[model samples]
Target: MRTACFIDGYNVFYGLVAGTSFKWLNLPSLIQHIVHVEAPESQLTSIDFFTSGVKPSLASRGSQSKEAQDTYLRALIAKGVVVHYGRHQLEARNAPRFISKQSPPSRLDQVAIWKLEEKETDVHIAISMYRLASRQASLPAEERVQQLVLVSADTDMTPALKAIKEDFPDLRLGVILPHREGTKRTTPGSLKNHSHWMRRLVTTEELAAHQLPERVPTKKRPAIKPEYW
Candidate 1:
């Protein structure tokens, strides 16, 4: 069975890699592990990773600089991970801020701040999943994708998965929940309910085993791991 993997970059990062040293990930090996252990008969044909680039001014908000992110993205590309970029919608708005308890009860502080929201990643992932799943209709039976794998815990994808499954009853659907250690509920109920099978991603053992090399040799300058990563 030929399979394709779609990963939501921010979702995976927040759920799996945040506050950890496992930022340098080897996506192909991880997918291979999923296919080998769960669906032994399946073959991984491609991996689609969706994400938005970060801004340097927002570094205080736990975002990496564009240069650092680019290096990591380059490494992934060299490893055959297809990356789809989305833009971060930056906005300024007034948000409430807490003041000292001694302040008047009726008084509240409205501070102006900049907020960054990642857009289009979820849409891209959902569209890609359906598009790839539908390719089985036109391609030769052997060459078509027999299984569609999602590496995200976003419940927003449930409707798309359900629609695709209704159209392609024979296509296998799997979910790899990107939950990190200390997480209580890894898989969202809606996503899990729609998937034929589900698995937890970001285990310590698997992450350590699937890290990209410190230095990924590229045709141009090498894609080196960020020193602070």
Candidate 2:
């Protein structure tokens, strides 16, 4: 059976890879490993990676994080991963955040900060899934994709999944939840409820097995992994 994998890049980052040593991830290898573990009969045929560029204001630890991300993106393209980009937006609004430990909690205290948010990524992922499902539904069984794998913990994708399940009853859908802290939520109920199969977590061992090489050679230049990553 042929399969396609759709990844919500930021969602996976914050849910699994952030603050971890697995930043140099190899999407192709990851998909293969996932398929071997979760759906042995399925062959991964495509990968769609959705993400946004880094904002300028954020202070980065290593050689600018933006450069590192660009390098990674290029490497992914070299390996046949389709990259769909959104944009990061800076918003100024009054919002309540966790109180600082140094200061006493005050009910009236509010802070106005420049919050950077990635926009359109979820919408893009949803639209891509819808299009893929539509394509499959329109084609004959032999020509259609048998399975679609979604990697994310975002609840925003639930509606898309539900619709696909309703419309393409024969298509197999799987959800892979990025490994998350025990205190934090795992997969959203709606997403899991609609999927044919759900893998609750991505283990560290799997991540270790699928990391991109420290130095990835590209046509334009050598793409080096960020030292601090």
Give every collision pair in model 2.
none
- lDDT values of the candidates? 0.84, 0.83
| Candidate 1 residue pairs in backbone clash | none
Q: Judging by lDDT against the true structure, name the best candidate.
A: 1
Candidate 2 differs from the real structure by a C-alpha RMSD in angstroms, to one decimal, of 2.7
* TM-score of each model, paired residue for residue: 0.89, 0.89
Candidate 1 lDDT at 46 equals 90
Candidate 1 residue 126 Cα shift, in angstroms, is 0.9
Worst 10 residues of 2 by lDDT: 178-187
Off by over 4 Å in 1: 61-64, 96-111
Residues 25-125, candidate 1, lDDT per residue (tens digit)? 88889878977788899899899999988877776444456787888889988888999998899999877665777764332667788888889988999
lDDT of 2: 0.83
Task: Give the per-residue lDDT of model 2 (tens digit) for 150-181.
Answer: 99888888998998899889889999887654
